[model samples]
Target: MDLEGLLGPQHPVAAAALISPAGVTVASRGADLDADFEIGSISKAVTGLLYADALERGEIRRESTLGELLPLGDVPAARVTLASLTQHRSGLPGLPRSARPLRRAIALWRHGTNPYGDNLEQLLTQARKVRVGRPRTRYSNFGFELLGHALAGAAGRSYGRLLHERVIDPLGLDHFYLPKAVDQLGPNALIGRNRRGEPRQPWTGEAIGPAGGIRSSVRGVARLVAALLDGSAAGIAALDPVAPFGKGARIGAGWITIEAEGRQITWHNGGTGGFRSWAGLDRDAGTGAVILSATSVSVDPFGLSLLTEHTRTVLNS
Candidate 1:
């Protein structure tokens, strides 16, 4: 499909896997998968799954208020719930405006200048000032970050530790972790470059790991998608057409739904610095694809179009 031409070889690494209800599977770029790309917002789906598991285990209630789980101190964050947080209807800004000088934000947190201890409080404060949208749809990273903090608080652990214990270990996804320090990142980690093709320094956000910081291999992501599509996981089930938000272009828990060329596709895309990734599962046909790139460009639309066209051809055959 000329993927290499479309996305430079140094910037593109694509993986696809087709799953069947009878447990049959086929994969490309599956065996040797890249494990160290910054997965961006796709981490939200994983975080959502963790929260779903917590709900199932009674560790936390989906309807539980944020204020009940953490110390919001006069902040209207109490009005937000786990569901709202995942759904991005928590009235939070996309991110803190003060976070412009990303390095300074990191320094402030490192020096313990802010006790909510990160930009999370700043996000919540912005949310309080804004109008909460209707419960169904809106995209906000601020809300997801709040959800991360709330989940960690409820579980009595740090966000990274909770993700490891509840999601990664259980799923046997050994290759993923939220980097505590930039130096801990692997040698193969993708470097972000600007549109001008200038290398950009590695940037870290304060305490917003849950919102968009998860790294994974192409095959590892496929396994997770397979589990979800087959309903093999305890708390996760395949996309239900009758769910609250319609099947396409909707957010359920953490997954984004899309209907492409007659296939019901549930997917998520993530990007950070010099890395971009797209992961999707076609529920009706029981197939999925994952694309991981070391560039900041939007590769999901192209990948999705290719996967959708290929799946259609096969189904017609």
Candidate 2:
């Protein structure tokens, strides 16, 4: 497959790359393997890595709950297992009930307002008041926000610092970082664009960093992906499929695996007000790709197609 031709000049993605399992850059555009892009919900995978490492170190057990790590009390969701949070079966809503998401959605559609601004303290307070629904597989950014803090508290550090020490630095991913403030989203950070060509606000608030605030270049992501395949990452075991979620889908610590085209593809995609991202690898085929679109267009198909195509390339190479 023509990976470069696939990422033509007209694609909404400002920066993208195809990386080999040997940590070599196979193809790229708009930016090299080093420029930063907001990784969106891919941050959840980082949190998943932390959770897994914590378990390996005996810092926390797989079944550890928020209440055990923090002062979250007996809130139903607080008692959810770390594994459940990683797998998104914590029964926690996608957002805090206090968020009034219906209104937030309207605001986002009309004014492009960021729905997430609550600081860590406010988020924790809201989590205490949240009424979790029945136990089932439900994707929840709020649940991950809480899980990030809970893991940090247990480790006597902050989420950003823990992630740096445990995942980023160890993997030699120097380009990956959490944007702590608007200023942190500097020139290197790709400006996400709405459909109308208007720049969207950078998602940089502290409360949601663990869920969606990470920024990295395709190269950094490629390095991380390579590490995941090589077992060089301390938390690579987090990629193990542990719980079933949807038809032909299974959940790992922070990764999701789906059966497609006769291969089990482990992947995760992220989106924000203006940007979209897809990162995945086909272990059996030994190929992976990173698709980062500056516009909020879904790129899951492109990413998967790229991986499927890569399988053919590996066979021929």
Candidate 3:
């Protein structure tokens, strides 16, 4: 597991680690265990943990509607249940259909402009104009962003405050943070990298935080995933797989269950202007891995391989 090879000419700034159920680091490479990286949609998984924690605390239930927690009055999304949103069955559009979304996407890819600058107030204002679709297993950043804030409301706390109280502090995730600005990411956070290998701005701000604004070190992710393997309440709840998401995947609260090397892999991946991330677990094997890279090149395929093929190969050898 030296991964001495990761220091190759083509490798981007990255950190990869394997962890055991007993909370031990088996191997790692690329960046130091403490280096921070923007974890993109994997932020949703953390939000899911908060959602589940709310459920366990009896503040909300599976049947709780967004209309109750949020003021999305009479809209299609308001009728959607907490479970539906968590499972990606809300049918909320991936991005709230706004003016010139295509142009905005172009700006995102071409210029690395932050797609999510609207704060909570602005986000709620935009939500009022959104159109919800049929309930299906469609991934929706809008759904999660709203859901995160809604849950925070239900618990009488801000989303960041709630997450820190219930998840980060409990897990001792010293480095996990929802930065309101790029400078707050601090100097230790890895510089983001776009496909063209240029530095990119931090994809942060309150509106985007719940859906994709988490920053964390490799050790933080490893510890969080390890807790999942050990039956932590939020961890177990996040993998309930309430609905079938796609051909080889089940839409658990926030995690995706897919097949790899004849094994079922529970995983989530994140991508931003200049970063990519992956977290996966082979529950039956009692093993999991976390991968983060500054370059936007996806770590999904390689992350799955390490959790499946790589682990299999190592076991056999």
Candidate 4:
């Protein structure tokens, strides 16, 4: 793949990296491999790995309910299963029902401020007012936020601490981190630009960190992809598909698996107000790829193309 060419047009900053049995390569524009960018909902993929780890450690069970972990009161969300939440079949809305989501979205679009800045207590209070719907393959930020905190509660640690202890530390992903506030951001963190070329504030908050608030450098995510491919990452089982997501796609913990170029590709894409990210794996070929962009445009096609090319090369060889 023409990695440099692909990143050249990305607004402000973008980074792409690929890893195979041969090694890892990174190409970027407007930033180095160590510059952090908000990874958006790819945080769910991290949470998914944590969930799998929790299960393996016997800290939680698939049948565990939200009420068993979080103090969500007597609400429908409290009764949802951990399994359903992990696979996004929990029937919860993408955001808390009580959070006035439309207003928050309007604020985000008009002001470019963080709409998901609610703290954990606020998140729990909002969850108490939620009404669960029929099980389906809907994506739910609300569900993941709750699931991550629940996992943390089960492990007797905060989400950030738990992530560091279980995943980041072991993987040696130096620039991977969850910043609960803007001040926590590193000096090298890249400020994202909206599609209109306007600068936007970083999306950071303890409540939403698990769903869309983690940040990482190209090197950090590339290292993670390498770990996932080599079975050295915790919760490798999270990559296994457990349910039908959309047409011709299956959902795992937070990973999505689809057949492309005659290969089963497992991947996830994320978007916040001003950033877009994609990560994918061609497990059979022992190859993985990631794309992080400052603009909110979708990079899914580029990421898939890279992975498919790697798979095709392996098959031909």
TM-score of each: 0.79, 0.93, 0.92, 0.97
- For residues 181-242, what per-residue lDDT tens digits would candidate 2 score against the true structure? 87776567777777676777777777898899898887788888888777788777778898
What do the candidate models score in CA lDDT, each in turn? 0.65, 0.80, 0.80, 0.89
lDDT of 3 at 55: 79
Give the CA lDDT, 0 to 100, for residue 51 in model 3.
Answer: 82
Give the clashing residue pairs of candidate 3, or none: 193-274
lDDT of 2 at 99: 72
lDDT tens readout by residue for model 4, 213-271: 89999899999999999999999999999889989999888988999978899999999
**Alpha-carbon runs more than 4 Å astray in model 2:** 1-10, 26-33
Q: Pick the candidate with the highest lDDT.
A: 4
Any runs in candidate 3 off by more than 4 Å, and if so which?
A: 2-10, 26-31, 233-235, 309-317
- Writing each residue's lDDT as its tens digit, candidate 1 over 116-182 gives 2255466556544554545655677767877887888888998888987876777776367776456
Clashing residue pairs in candidate 4 (N, C-alpha, C atoms within 3 angstroms):
none
Model 3 vs. true fold: TM: 0.92
Best TM-score among the predictions, by candidate number: 4
Our model 1 lands, by Cα RMSD against the true structure, at 5.3
Q: Which run of 10 residues does model 4 get worst, by summed lDDT?
A: 1-10
